[model samples]
Target: MSERGRGDRRGGMSRGGRGGAVRGNRGGMGGRGGRGGGGDRRKGREGNNNRQAKKKGGSKVIIEAHRHRGVFIARGKEDMLVTLNMVVGNTVYGEKKVVVEGSSPEEKKEYRQWNPFRSKLAACILRGIRDIYMGPGSKVLYLGAASGTTVSHVSDIVGPTGAVYAVEMAHRPGRELIEVAKIRTNIVPIIEDARYPAKYRMIVPMVDVLFADVAQRAQAQIFSINASNFLKNDGHFVISIKASCIDSTVAPSTVFSKVRDELIENQFKPIEQISLEPYERDHAVVTGVYRPSKKEKAPE
Candidate 1:
């Protein structure tokens, strides 16, 4: 597995600025206080108005449900992928937060901005991948959950009813993942190698989806073993393949094709293959069902 790093702090699409699509007017008050303290009082009133305006500016952005369940699109100056924040007023990985006021107090929802540059899953969604398999209440087994950056968002998507079993072998990132899990109870951080599922087999149960992002030469093999261990019959699997990680000597297309064939050989029916372009180079996301259940024939 390759080391994961926070690539960029920018949380949304690059339309005209880096501070996201939403912006507010920052009114400046400059001048010495008057003899009666009128200037100071006036400046104070103006500052309060500016603060109120700033708060109002954020509300202009609209939240709409995306084609995929549990995923949403924040529409404003530019479109951004977002997920409802499970832990309100708390942030994971320092991503931007959007607060949307609902009709009722209990209806108020907070969404976390998902950056494609920082997360491969975000990139896959932005790239128009058909189906992710896991949604609300869908249990997931995530391999190579480095620092739980993407896992946290997956946690948000799954909400409280669902669970995400995140496995990270590296001690440093595994620690960070544990911290994320502490905040979001839905995530179960497992510090173990993904190659051997037997080690953590007791902790993880049959999951609706198995997602693998271990950028290793034997990633396909790793995915296969885990799928066999935890994935349910007719369950789906999503794997992110790094071309260079497999064979740097060959072209990326060749590597992708070979990996696809390898997955097919392991009984994975490839549904859609999406290229993570602009966000990540020489990388692709392959998703499909594992051992799809055979449909019964109609009466002849």
Candidate 2:
């Protein structure tokens, strides 16, 4: 593992620019948008049928829209709800909140789609995270909020007042992110590189939790630099590391070891290390406390 100095400036970073940045999760679909190939007309037809059904369904779980993996179903598929849902509905809005909506007078509609691959909160739970600081009103810096799938869940968890800085450097994904932000005013979209936190600092407020899913080699260093400027001292830092991106030449264990050491050097305390199997291949999720001055503990 090379010490890509902060701002992503390191031995391996020469291939890419040296600015810190994060946000993008197509749930491992390779970040390609919904422009599914080989069936252009079919896409339009399917959308029409779904919309027609939703218009007549009336307070039902209508298959409202289509994304890459599946269709978006909604009960109040009305214009207002549709508009609101587009914002915090499927993106990470940075607030930690749990909304209990009742489908019927006696029924409870309490649930949020948990995408383990994109959002580390679900990944950490699968990895057995005892306590995630992502509950109600928690401020979060959501990195890699591609297309807003997992970010929507984060918005539900964080609620309204709290904010989430959804950062994405990719233009294609950033467009969708902007749409999601338009409805969810709390989420501020920054179409800048994550390696350079200062560049996007004006849009960013202090955050209690920093969640990153950037599949870059110098991720640990990127997180460190971002944390110094953004994360609260005792706040939480959740990172999803793609083993293949780090050092493909060495074993996964070696790569993880090197990255963990670097995090320690940067003053982050590693509390949990987890592997995401069904969701991501040979990928790992790490949850750590940002301790800028304390002695780092041994890797768990």
Candidate 3:
């Protein structure tokens, strides 16, 4: 399969720099002033006016269900891809939060903005990939879950009924992932090398979906081995490949073609291949089913 044509970078969603940098709010008025002073009163009035103007200028946001289940779009000042927050009042990687008021106080719902620049999965979605193979109540096995950035979003998509087994080899990011898991009970953080799935076999079961974002040179092999151990037959697999990491000498298209062949040889039926351009250069996301079940013919 060929990668999708590269499109212009989406401008509406917040762009968190590479490595999931925090995108803090900018252009806010700041100053210190004495209480009950005329300046303070004037500033208060101006603040009130600004809030009123903002409210008047179409600041009302409406949440609409996205094509993919468990994913949503917040439309207002800017359209942003969002997932319902599993843990209320917590920010995983400093993403923008959108709160929607319900009929009652307890009914209020919050969503976390998903940045494509910070996540390959998000990039894939924005690039109009046909299927994610994941939704609410899907059991996911996530490899290379660094600091639980995308893992947190996956947890949100899976909701409470589902689970995410996050594996990270490095201790530094593993620690952060552990902290993220502590808050979201659905996530199980396993700090171990993904190359050796047997080491953590006891903690992980055969999952419905396997996602790998490990940019290692042997990433295809790693995905194949892990899929063999933890992925159920006919289960879906989504893997992000960094062409440079695999081989900088060859063209990215060549690298993707080679990886697609490797996956095919390893019992993966590739469904779609999409380029993660604008958000990530020279990167591609490949998704397909593992050991797909054969269809039975109709009675003749």
State each model's C-alpha RMSD to the native.
Answer: 6.9, 15.6, 7.3
Which residue ranges in model 1 land beyond 4 Å of their true spot?
1-52, 55-59, 103-105
Residue 70, candidate 2: C-alpha displacement in angstroms? 23
From the highest lDDT down, the ranking of the candidates is 3, 1, 2
Candidate 2: tens digits of C-alpha lDDT, residues 1-300: 101001111111111112311311112111223444344565556555544433442122322331211112223222111112323223243221112334564442222334354455555564555555675567889887787666665665566766778888899989988887777766788887889999988878789989998889889888889999999888888888888898888888788888889988998888888777665677777787886456689999
Name the lDDT of candidate 2.
0.60
Candidate 1 — what's its lDDT?
0.82
lDDT of 3 by residue, 102-154 (tens): 67879767888898888899999988999999999999999999999999999
| lDDT, candidate 1, 1-300, per-residue tens | 111111122332332223444444444442354332435656756756765655553324667888888888777556677888899878876676667666787876787888888888889998999999878999999999999989999999998999999999999999999998889999999999999999999999999999989989999999999998999989999999999999999999999999999989988999999999988999999999999988999999
Q: In angstroms, how far off is 18's CA in candidate 3?
A: 6.7
Ranking by TM-score: 1, 3, 2
The number of the candidate with the highest lDDT is 3
The lowest-lDDT stretch of 10 consecutive residues in candidate 1 is 1-10
Q: Which stretches of candidate 3 lie over 4 Å from their true place?
A: 1-49, 53-58
TM-score of 1: 0.85
Evaluated at residue 101, the lDDT of candidate 1 is 63
